[model samples]
Target: MKKTVFITGASSGFGKETVRLFHEKGWNVAATMRSPEKEGELAALDGVLVTRLDVTDEGSIAAAVKAAVGAFGGIDVLVNNAGYGALGALEAASDAEIRRQMEVNLFGLIAVTKAMLPHMRERRAGVIINVSSVGGRVTFPFTSLYHATKFAVEGLTESLQYELNPLGIRTKIIEPGGYRTEFAGRSMSAIGAGGIDAYRQPWDKMVEVLAGWPMSGNIREVADAIFEAATDGTEKLRYPVGQDAEQLLAGRVQMDDVAFKKMMVGQIGI
Candidate 1:
C-alpha cells in the first residue's frame, strides 16, 4: 500500500516541492494551504488532495486532517511547513507582530502536531517532519522574532522525539539555509510601523546581503531531506540541509561565542 503524507504550506516552497516529489514516488499526498484554490497545480495532480488548512485555526486544522484521512485512508507522514519570517529588531517589533510570528511558526506547529499525534499514535508507525531553519539553531540581526519561533520549534521537536520514539513515532527537524524559494519573498515580513529609515544601515545591509547570496539550494534539497527523515530510521534527530546550514552549525559548535558572532555578522551582514 502506498503511504500517505499530509503536508502544510503546500502552496509553495519546500511544501509544494515535497508534495510533487512524494506524489512522484507513489505516495498519496494531502497538500494543504491557507487557500486551496491557490494551489491549482498541486490540486490537479493525480493522487494529490489539496485542502484548505490554516494552522493557526484549530477548526481548519481538524477539518484538513479529517479530509486527508478520508482521502488517503490514513496519514503516514505529517510535514509541518506552514510558517513565515518575522524580520525586525526585537525591541522594534510590535506586540501584534510578535504574536503573529509565534502563532504561525511555533504555536501553530504545536497545534497541528497535537491534531495529528493521535492518528500516528494509533498506527504506531509515522513520521513528523518539522520544517525548521538554520535560524532555529542560531540567531541573526533583524530576525530575532523569526529565530525565536524556530528555536521554539527546535526545542519542541527535540522533546517530542524523545516522547514519541518509544511509541514508534518518529520526529525530525529539517534545518535548511539559503534555499532558493518563495520563502525569501512571500513568507518574509518586516515588523515596526514605519519605513526602512528607522533601521538605516543595518536593515539595508541585511537586505543587500540576503539579495546577493547564492540561491544555490533549491526546494529539492529540502524535499529530499524531508523524504529521508520520513523513510530513514536512523537515530539522528536533526537533518541540516544545504551547505550554509552545515557550515553554520559547525561554526557555532567549534568557534568561541565572540568569534562565531563576528564570523556570522561578517558573512551575512546580519
Candidate 2:
C-alpha cells in the first residue's frame, strides 16, 4: 500500500513541489491549501486530493485532515508548510499583524499537528515535518515578528520529539535558507505607511543586499529534504536545507552572539 502524505500550503512553493515529488514516488498526497477551488495542477493528478485547509482555522484543519484520512486510509506524513512572513520594524507592526503572524506560523501549525496526533499515535507510526526557516534559528532586520514565530516552531518541534518519540511518531523541523519561492515575493508582506518610516532606510538597504545575493529558484531541494525527513525512518529532529542555511547554522554554532551580530551587520548591511 502506498503511504499517504498530507501537506499544508500546497497551492505553491515547497508545498506544491513536494506534492508533485511524492506523487511521482507513488504516494497518496493530501495537498491542502486555503483555496482548494483555485488549485490547478495538483487537482488534476491521480492520488492527489486538493482540499481546503486554513491552518489558522480549526474547523478547516479538522475537515482537511478528515478528508485526507478518508480518501487515503491514513496519513503517514504531515508537512506543516502553511505560513508567511510579516516584515517591518517590530514597533511598526500593528497588533493584528503581530497576532496574525503568530496565528498562522505558530498556532496554526500546532493546531494542525494536534489534530493529527491522535490518529498517528493510535497507529504507532508517523512523521510530522514542520517547515521553519533559517530565520527560526537566526535573526535579521525588520523580520522580528516572523522570526518570533519560527523560533517558537523550532522550540515546539524540539519539545514535541520528547513526547511523540515514545509513541513512534517522529517530529522533524526543516529550516530552509533563501529559496526563490513566494516567500521572497508574493507571500511576503511589508507594512506600508502604517509602519514607522524611520526604518525605511535600513529596510531598503537590506532589500538591496538581498537583491545581490544568489537566489535558488529550485525549491525541489526543500521538497526532497521533506521527503527524506518523512520516509528516512530516522528519529532525527532537524534538517536544514540549502548551503545558505547550513552555513548560517554552522556560524551560529561556532560564533558567539556578539560575533554573529557583527557578521549580520556586515552581511545584511543593517
Give TM-scores for every candidate, taking all chains together and pairing residue i with residue i. Answer: 0.95, 0.97
Cα lDDT computed for each candidate against the true fold: 0.88, 0.91
TM-score of 1: 0.95
**Which pairs of residues have clashing backbones in candidate 1?**
none
Candidate 1, residue 19: lDDT: 95
- Segments in model 1 whose C-alpha atoms lie over 4 Å from true places: 192-198, 268-270
Residues 158-220, model 2: lDDT tens digits:
999999899999999999999998886767888633445777788888778767878788799
Model 1 Cα displacement at 256 (Å)?
1.6
Which segments of candidate 2 are over 4 A away from where they belong? 192-197
